[model samples]
Target: MLLARIIKSIVIIIFSCILLKIIQYLLKKLFEFTKFDTRYEKTLCSVLSSISYYIIFVVSLILILREFNIVDVTTFGTLVTGASIVGLIAGVASQSILKDIFNGFFILFEKQIQVGDFIVINEEFRGSVEEIGIRSTSLRDWDLKRITISNGNITSIRNFSKNKMRVVSHVRVSYEEDPMKVIESLEEVCSIMNDKFDEYLLKNSEGKSISEFKVYGVTDIEKNPVGAQYTITGVVESYRYFSASKEVKLQILIVFKKNDIKIAYPTHINVLHYDNDYKNEL
Candidate 1:
């Protein structure tokens, strides 16, 4: 009976470990096959794996203890007590940690945003999502600094990177030029820029989703220039290039320079000397 019990114990242990591995592997693969974002999928995989592991470990322990002759009311009670203590510690530590995990999980599972999402949180931090972990999310700030934020603190999320990003360039031309001609030329310039930028290499939010680019017209204005410049608001699409918005703006400047279209600028004029005929001093 002793030998039989030992053999049974060995089989149970081996089976438990194998079961854990299989569960983990399968969970990972299931998410991998979905159309969901990789970061969210990966986070989900880890979370499920961790929970499953603990449950399996606890169950295996109970079974192992039962197989031993030492299994009794006192022994079982002791085991339960020990498990509760460990659980309490973990639970306390995991409160904050779990909030983060929940936030991250909801962000992805609920389709709020993904790893490659270009999001602005609290109207302050704007960047591409570099990583989505259980506790915090990592983002590369505008200055290329890595910013890690707790998921629980994410109050407002502006997902501008998920879809197409609009690049608006308000170009002002001299009123001396024909409004129609300049508008047409500006449109053509924008088209050329769009085509050129199509070939310009750009990085994705997650460094995974690579794309060429697309442009669209937002609006235009041939209205009162502060002095003599007509404002033309040309909005274009730089989808998947929010991170490269700066670069897109630079290209617009280059186009303006090459085309000799003066960009809008505010200026104040002061008449130094009175040139107009005026009575000496009344």
Candidate 2:
């Protein structure tokens, strides 16, 4: 009888393995070849497979007990009671962990954000979505900073790369330059960029620019200075930044350089400081 039960358990285990393999094959054929939009797909599949696998093992346990003629109610009651106590303790102690796990399930279902998405949350951090787990989502910022945010803390989300991103850069120039002239110079720069990117920068495609990215003249800046020496103080806000490549920044740099305008740098100038101080002291 023991040998017969062993054979039965082995056969059940083999059948369960075959069933799981079939399910896996069907799921693969169902979803198209899309890269890991979510880590939970095959991972969840494996979790399910493990659960099913355990069910088979449990059946084997019952069969083996019956074969040994020791399938008694008292033994079953002892096992169930111990399992219940352990489960109760785990449920109480792991509420937060369970919450994260449930939230992670919703995240996967709703597709809040996926890997390789650019998102900003709470002004605390912004970067590419590296990994989204049940507990936390990992991000790698532009500066190569890795941050993990819990699913609970992620209330507000700003996904910039969902469709297209507007790369905005602001340029502040002296109020002396004509707003029209600056715009015109920028338009010329835009013209050049349009031609250079015609092959790659795509929008309407009829010799048109990639996208209508242009310079909006001076916004606002405080005229007041340290000692009121600098008269023309203002800021220009430029919008429509859509270059996936790093060429946009370079183009802006060249635009400023060609226009004889330079990015601001911090410097302190003292006029005859030593002589004046010495003379005053004397």
lDDT tens string, model 1, 1-282? 888888888998999999999998898778867997675676566556657877888787667766774343356676676667657867887888788778877876776766666788878888877766556777887789998888888888987744444444444555555666555555665565446555333446664324332333323444555424322222323353443456556655776677666655667888767644654652
Best by lDDT: 1
User: How far is 79's C-alpha from truth in model 1 (Å)?
Assistant: 4.4
Give the Å shift of residue 31 in candidate 2.
Answer: 5.7
Encode model 2's per-residue lDDT on 1-282: one tens digit a residue.
Answer: 667877876776687678768776765565446565444354444335445555665565555554555453357775575556547766895777677667766866776776666788777789877766667778899999899887766777786655444444455555555556566666665565555644434344364433544554454456423111111111111112234334555666687678875444445887764667788889
Position 22, candidate 2: lDDT: 76
Give Cα-based local distance difference scores for all models: 0.63, 0.58
Q: Which stretches of candidate 2 lie over 4 Å from their true place?
A: 1-76, 140-147, 198-211, 223-245, 264-267, 271-282
Stretches of candidate 1 exceeding 4 Å from the true structure: 1-74, 79-98, 142-144, 173-177, 194-255, 270-282
Best by TM-score: 2
Clashes, model 1? 0
Model 2 has a clash total of: 0
What's the CA error at residue 180 for candidate 1, in Å?
2.1
CA lDDT, candidate 2, residue 87: 70
